[model samples]
Target: MLWRAISEELPGPKWAGLFAEYWPFYRKWWLKEGEPARPTYAECRRALKAHMPDLIPLYEDLCDQAGGGDLAARFLSFYCPPPYLSGCSQAVWGGKEPVMVRNYDYNTNAFDSLVLHTGWKGRRVMGTSDGLFGLVDGVNDAGLSISLTFGGRRVVGVGFGVPLILRYVLQTCETAEQAGEILARVPTHMSYNVTVLDRKRKYLTALMAPDRPAIITKAAVATNHQENVEWISHARFTATVERERYLLQRLRFHRDPEEKFINTFLKPPLYSHQFNAGFGTLYTAVYRPRKREMEHRWPGTVWHQKLDAFEEGSRNVLMPGIVA
Candidate 1:
């Protein structure tokens, strides 16, 4: 079902090829385990099968189109991991739903918001069917807010994959606690830190791994590295720590209407800070789900750019209701 959706909506052969390439990397990390017999790939697959069986055929179709050899190579490249860092900011405002903004900058330019939607059952089962789907940062009709950062060094074997996790969080969970419970129970393949905010704007939680979870009593923030977790230290994040600090400071001092906050500050024309290293900011985005009915503002609105094209220091003010 998920692959079918991709075949129906995306450019066929190219998308299928991409999916095949990434599948082995995904399977290797999630299925093969070492010391701690964490979550098994079989278990994760079963969970999706039981919860979202409709997507299996879709993935199979995509794999068949991609062939086997090319798919294997892509998997190897993905699992190797790269030394890159990404920084972003998200904000929620208006109505019961949450809005969001993010800056995705990396050494190698390979980012894409493949698709967007409002369903989870179809997605949870499909996993990373083709490319990433839905809003990497978004709010559901239920008014919950969610966003992510690659675990980088900390990511171990894969459990519930990132794309699937995002889809499940948006589709099934309604509050930060519920989202945390899902994160806590699942055996994760990679090391990722997810921040989930609820509708009332009263509660916020940051789930760092399968075992550690923390509550954010005040305004919350997350960078590429884990926060409040002991196994890692802030020092290890030296490469991108400044970027994270600048974002936190900006959010702390940010003063303006929600739209203005996103447009004037978050959207860019960013001032160079001492902490910034490597290619500044690739692209900045502000998404107010409630304000724009879950549509992404900026690049989607102004330049009609693909997410992979985002570069450091790129800035644009997006109009309302535009989508790729």
Candidate 2:
């Protein structure tokens, strides 16, 4: 069962074309409806192709294997733009970033289990064309984990950006540190807070951008804004003050390692518009992948609810089984 669960199932050629078709609409929303000077499809494609040549071919191959083209057109009719504020700004017990946490149960050699909550949008591609967007959270085969938080800023530039960054981390890196290294060198067009967890369950790191150097701060907490890193502030001091305040408040609670924090936050009445609207935790997810040999709190029920919301808002099919 474990082997089957982790097995790699590639997609066909038609699926790859579907993914290509979806990019334009996905970019339209991400760049905010009619803002000019946004990166062109050719430019974004070029950047992705240049930086991740190996993965692009693999992605194409996966799409081809999964059967591509018309499947994407058929699904394209269902594609819905993701809502702007559809992300969470909550805590993860024993988490390193705002919405990411992992547990290593030494007693059971369980390796690891993780929970990743996200905002903005994320996608899952099998071969290429038939991929589904809006995945905000996922755990990797390596047991490393990741989640995203929003980062707003006045200053902007032109370069490889956020969605690609998320894809890069999930597709290539196997640990928090490796993801950090990738962020250190990549050029980003905007600011974002990316949190990563490693396989050993030993470290969590957040990488914020718009500056050359990266800060490796030690904390079990993070949120949708920037933290008070002196160098980061020195470079763009005035712009991120409000974001800093949010970050400070999120740090008030020391994450409790045993609590299944995200799950607790996502239950019932709390999962609806009242809580999500009031607190700005638009969506949440908790993924535990270690029960094959061990046990921990399971939030499958809560995640399914959030998944439904994501599907309704985006008009994209939810591929829960892919992640499962």
Question: Could you say which candidate leads in lDDT?
Answer: 1
TM-score of predicted structure 2:
0.55
At residue 177, candidate 1 shows an lDDT of 76
Clash count, one per candidate = 16, 24
TM-score leader = 1
lDDT of 2 by residue, 1-324 (tens): 010011122443433444454456544544464434344434444655666554466544443443444333222222221222212332334443323432111111111112222221122221001124212345445555555544444344544445455556656666677877776666555555666655455445455565544456445444434554343542242223433343334345533344444444444322322221223223343433221011122234222312112221111222121222
| RMSD values, in order shown | 8.8, 11.4
Candidate 1, TM-score vs. the true structure?
A: 0.56
lDDT of 1: 0.43
Query: For model 1, where is the 10-residue window of minimal lDDT?
Result: 303-312
Poorest lDDT segment (10 consecutive residues) of candidate 2: 104-113
